[model samples]
Every structure is written in C-alpha cells, then in structure tokens.
Target: MAAAHRARHWSFGGVVLVVTAALVAAVLISFSGSVAPRADAAVAAQTWSDEFDGVAGHAPDGAKWTLETGGSGFGNHELQYYTNSTSNAALDGQGHLVITARKNTDAGLGCWYGQCQYTSARLNTARTFTQAYGRFEARIKIPRGQGIWPAFWMLGNDLGTVGWPNSGEIDIMENIGREPNTVHGTVHGPGYSGAGGLGAAYSLPGGRAFADDFHVFAIDWSPNSIVWSVDGTTYKTLTPADTGGKKWVFDHPFFIILNLAVGGDWPGSPDGSTAFPQTMTVDYVRASSSGSAPVARPIRGIGGMCVDVAGASSADRTPIQLHNCTGNAAQQWTVGNDGTVRAFGKCLDVAGGSTADGAIVQLYTCNGTNAQKWTYTAAHDFTNVGANKCLDAKGNSSADGTRLQTWRCTGAAGQKWTLG
Candidate 1:
C-alpha cells in the first residue's frame, strides 16, 4: 500500500492510500534494524483471524474489519467505487468473503471518472486490529479478467499522521489480471514505492492460473525481515539492506487490507474481453503476532486544490475542473504511456478534438488523436500537442469547480501543474 511516485497500481502495488504530501506529519519511527525472533525461539500465539463463517449474504464481522468506501482511485487510477453495500462484499455460508466487481454504470458513486462504471469493495483491519510483529496469511481464489486487480496487503497504522511511504507497506500478495499465473509480494517505504517498490513474482507451475483453486498467500514477519510465500512455499524475503539504505519504515504497527480493483494504469482499462461481476473469493484470513498487524497520495493542481473530473463522469466532454482535493478517484490522474493524462479510463481531451487556443478541455474516450495527446514539460506546463497550447485554469481562479481550458502558453500560474 505505497502511494508514491507515479500512479500506484496496487503492486507496491498497483495500490495506495489517498493522503497528501502537504498534510504529511513528518513523523518517522526509527526502530532498531535487528531481526525478529526466529520461529524456533518462540511459539507465536494466534491473535485474530476471519473464517468468513458468517451467514450467507451478510457483511463480514464489522468489529473485525472496516469497509473503506470510495472511488478515489486509491492513487492507482482504479475504476471501481468501493462501497459498503453487501452486494459488493458479502459472506457465503460455505466459508468465504466474496468481494465482487460489477459493471454498474448506474451506481451513481462519484469515481475518478464521472459516474462509477463499476462497483466493488475494499476492507481493512485498520480500526479493529493492529499488530507490530508475527505472521499474516490468507487463503484466496482470485478472479480473472483484463483489468481486475486483487490484493492482500498491510500498511502502517500511522498512515494518517505520517502519510504514505513514510507509513511503510508490505504487500503479501497482489495479482493483476494479465498475469494469471503470477502473483507479487513487495515492500514499500520512504525511498521505495509505487512502480519503484522492491518485490518479486511467484508463479504457479506450467501454464497454471491461480484462480483454479484456493491458495494460501502469506508473509512471515520479524523486525526487519518479511518473507513471502505461496502455499507454504517461501519465494522471497526482504530487509533494510534490500532498500539500498532507504529508511526501514516497517518496524511499527500495521493493519491488513483486502481489495479487488477493476482497472488502472498498471493493469490498463478493462476491455471487451473482460467479463463483469468478477469475484475475489477469500476463504479465510488470519493474523497472529509473531507479533501484530498493517496504508493515499493525491494529485494537486492550481489554487493548491486538485484537477478533478466534473461529476466524476467519464462521459465524453465532461468538464475537467478545479475542485477542493477530496483525494477521490476523480482526482487521480495518470500520465499514460501514450502521452495522455487519464482518469477513470478516459483521456484529458480538447473539447470536440479542437486544437485552437482557448479550447475547452474535458474528459473523453481515449482516441489516439492530437486532442488527447499532451506533453507535461519540465516547466510543469501541460502543452496540448495539436494546438501547442497549455492547460490553464479559468481566470487563474482556485475556486472549486473552475473550468479548465487550453490557452496560448504564457508561463502563467494557472497553467502550471504538479503531478504525484
């Protein structure tokens, strides 16, 4: 759960927390980098776990988890709005917590895109539990699709106060749909996170997709050490030295998080080949202190607010305006590989594909045209490729809902931008 440089894809993950740099508390915890006690040295006690034995169609135990509801993109430019509704997250009596992602353009949840095109759920143990040290594991059957992203991870409980990266994060498992045979485990801290996160991949042998059955994904932790394993097969381990001297921020308490995202930068947007109503069936999740348990980042624009999609809509020509940064999905923008700035699976476009000066800017379907192409230069100006104009907030106003337009580049404050 590291929300660092670039849009996190939930892998360091292609995932994230929505806190901002300006609000970060600068509180760093320096714990001794000594190794945690070895397994033979002490018998770890079982502290907490979820069997998903609740009545079918019911929500998971509220006392043991907190349902995070939002479509803020979670720093990943993800497409789905995580909701508290049982329709998105519920238990099956047979023993499983099913987090489902559905095609729901009518959900009306404000997403990074205008109307949320999809709906899912994200759950965490942030309020119910926090462990400093031990083991965390889960048995899961992941769903498959072009843009589905499923993960089991941990984040520092000090996230709110310290912000991300500094809060530390340990991803036990993260599987993007494209890599059906592989899953990743990673660590994100002060110097390493997002696409730069340090981690490794573990794959099922020979053309096997993990969705075939339930598999145990887990991490054994002790002090500076964290080991990742699949089905009890250890594949990777990490420590302070592995960070190239970056501060080891994982020494404190953390909480668990589980989520299924629909689309984002790393996983790309869902396409025709993708089927809707995908489900991540979690058989069980357990935690015990060997110890204890485990992360937002945002994009800021003119007026110290954020560049946001009006109405969180993805419909063609929706105004891309300035708004009080809510850190929601609407504000999560990604500088795509194709030179397009995207949000909610759509591109920042010059209205009507016009390249003329003073052209209105809006959200539109990515159509590989000059109107959608842009260059974010070293000077922080977003130069529209076709018109050679810069994106400027109207009237140099910082007011929420100020519309944006493309104007002749004049080195104006209204034309400057800072991407996360």
Candidate 2:
C-alpha cells in the first residue's frame, strides 16, 4: 500500500508530545573517538569504510563499531530487548553485516517493559568513527513484516554533552515494514526535533517494496545544505531556509548508527500476521567527501593574499582589501547559496552604493540589497549586481597595496580572480 507517513504525537497527563521524541531526548547520549581517515579539501576521497566481511556467525569488527545494548523502550516504548548476542547481529562471511530480529519468547531479564516480545541489535560508530562534512552511504536489503523498523542514521558528535534536540539528528535511511515501498530521510534539530522534524521520503516506482531488493541510501552533506538520494536518484535537498528561522546547528561532526527496531510508536507492534526472524542485510557502509570546495573557505588572490576586511572590523564601509592570509575570520569568506560573499556575517558591498567607475568595494551588514549580491563567472570575474560592473585590481597591478574597484568587464587579467 502506497501512502504518506505523518509525524505522530502522543499525550500523557497534561503534556502533548511524541513518545519517540521523548525517548530520544531523555535517552540516547554519547561521545567518543575513532581512528577514521580524514577527507581532503580538494577532490573526493573515501574517508571511512566497512565491508562487513568476516567469518560466518561472528560479530562485526570491533575497531569499527560497538554494540549499543539495552531494552528500556529505546525512548520509543519499543518491544525489542537489544542484546550483544551474535544471533542478533553478525557478519555472514559473504560480505554482509546481518542484523536479525526474532520473536523473543524466552523469558529472563531481556525485556524492558514486562515480557520481551522480540530481540534485536543496535550497532553504533560512536567512539569508532565520526565525521563533519561528507557523503554517508549504505547499501542494504531490509526485512518485511508488520512491526519491523530498520534505520541507518546519525547524531551530532556532541550528543553526549548537549543531548538530543540540541545535538541534532540526521536520518539517512529509515524504513518501517508497514511502508515497505517508502524510505524516509529526515533531520532533527532545536526547533525542528521529534514530530517537528523536517524531511522527505522516496518510494519505489511501480509499487515495488524496498525489501524486495538491495538499495543504496545516501546523503551528501555540505556546509548548510544536505541532499538525499536513493539508488542514485536525488529526491530532496534541504537548507537553513527550510527551517522556520531556527538555528542551523548541524555545522559540526556526527557519528553513525544502524539498528533493527521491533515495535515502536511509528510501526506499532508485531501481531499474529507478523513472521519471525526477519533480517536486514547490509552489504557495505562508506563515508566520503568531495573534499573541501573553495566556496566554503576563504578566497585568495594574487601575491597569495586573502580578501580581507579592513582592520578586521564589522563596521559598514570597511575597506575590503587584500592582506596577508592569516586564516582569520576577517579573511574567511563564504560564497553563500544566496549569491553573496560573506565575511563576519556581513556581505561584500560597493562603497557608498555607487555604480560609477572606480567605486571602491567594502564590507557592509548583510541586508539582501542588490549591492551585496555578486555573480562569479568561470572566467574569474566578480560582477556586482548593484553596479553591474566587474571587480578589478587597479592598473592590473598584482602588488599587495593595489586598490580594488569596479570597472567595465574588459576580460582583462586585472579583473580575473582565482579561488584558492
């Protein structure tokens, strides 16, 4: 059945909130380290990877991930008791990490609420691997049943200190068995956590269930944007503008997690129609970065000097000059998605709002004004939206003290700039 998944909320006493949200907020907190490979700034590279190839019926590599074991509803009143047993999670020797969920009729101390009806495993790269900006991907075939939930997600690296709703959460792939044809990708932060999270879903075409085959789920995360895709088809792209003026708090590192949950507020409970011993098979998991592009970093020019703000000031009309690249905030510029060059939260502007030839360029508080917008061309010309002129180095001088001004687009060497 093809349908849409809506965020659900629950009420207890006088408080109306989502059970799953409370579970995540009240529980799930950690911080650790891993010897993960670092990504380069230019060109894409595989930073961290796991093939899940090991002896049959054995646990996954201890150097990559560790099991997160518990049964306390996992913050969502889940019926599964998570254990470190190999029966619940292991490598199949055939190049796959297999997570199996079974009906736990065996009594004992396994259950979180009353008798445990199911058992599963949760694996996390908390202290083993974490990254800031990169592409996170995994290929897997999920289980199908009434109450099975399989997810590959991430939490901010500061989770152990700041806690949920503050640490941020990114759901790269989440599939409830009830919606076998659809998988969701969501991000949760301050004002947009829990039932208020912002996200989108991708469903298989032709009414096909995702459980019928292995599919690639991935997210390409950059400075303030994230793009989601399934099987190489991008379905959603989110940015700070999507948030309702809330803080963009995902500008830090995060860790990975993979788990098979049984019976949660979203998927409900396994009933008579459900089968036993369902499994989610993961062929591999990898994280990569297209390296750091110039747009996200400070821009440099001739003489190896950085585009600087005069005196490192935040005042309007501060001269935008070329200075020794110190890698300071004053010299750090961001080519915003809005087409403005920003430094210290201010936009690069033309002094006195002039359009005349030789008008000096300066830094001003960003106000979305035309003077603040610039369009960079492949030829390395910075065209000001307000003056409709090109940013040029006076007299074609590459000297450090040469002043910067607006001039006609002459395609001259002086007007050309290169991002470093």
Which candidate has the top score in lDDT?
A: 1
Across residues 84-202, which tens digit of lDDT does each residue of candidate 1 receive? 89999999889999999998766457886788899998888766677766679999999998989998998887776777778888889988888899998888887788768887889
* Prediction-by-prediction clash tally: 34, 3
Q: Write the per-residue lDDT of candidate 2 for residues 131-215, one digit (tens) a residue.
A: 7766799999999988888989887766655667677888889888888799898888888877778888898999999989999
List where candidate 1 sits over 4 angstroms from the true fold: 1-6, 9-42, 105-107, 291-420
Provide the TM-score for each candidate, comma-separated: 0.62, 0.66
Report residue 57 deviation for candidate 2 (angstroms): 1.1
Candidate with best TM-score: 2
**Candidate 2 positional error at 68, Å:** 1.0
Per-model lDDT: 0.76, 0.73
Error of 2 at 346 (Å): 24
- Between which residue pairs do clashes occur in model 2? 23-75, 33-127, 41-292
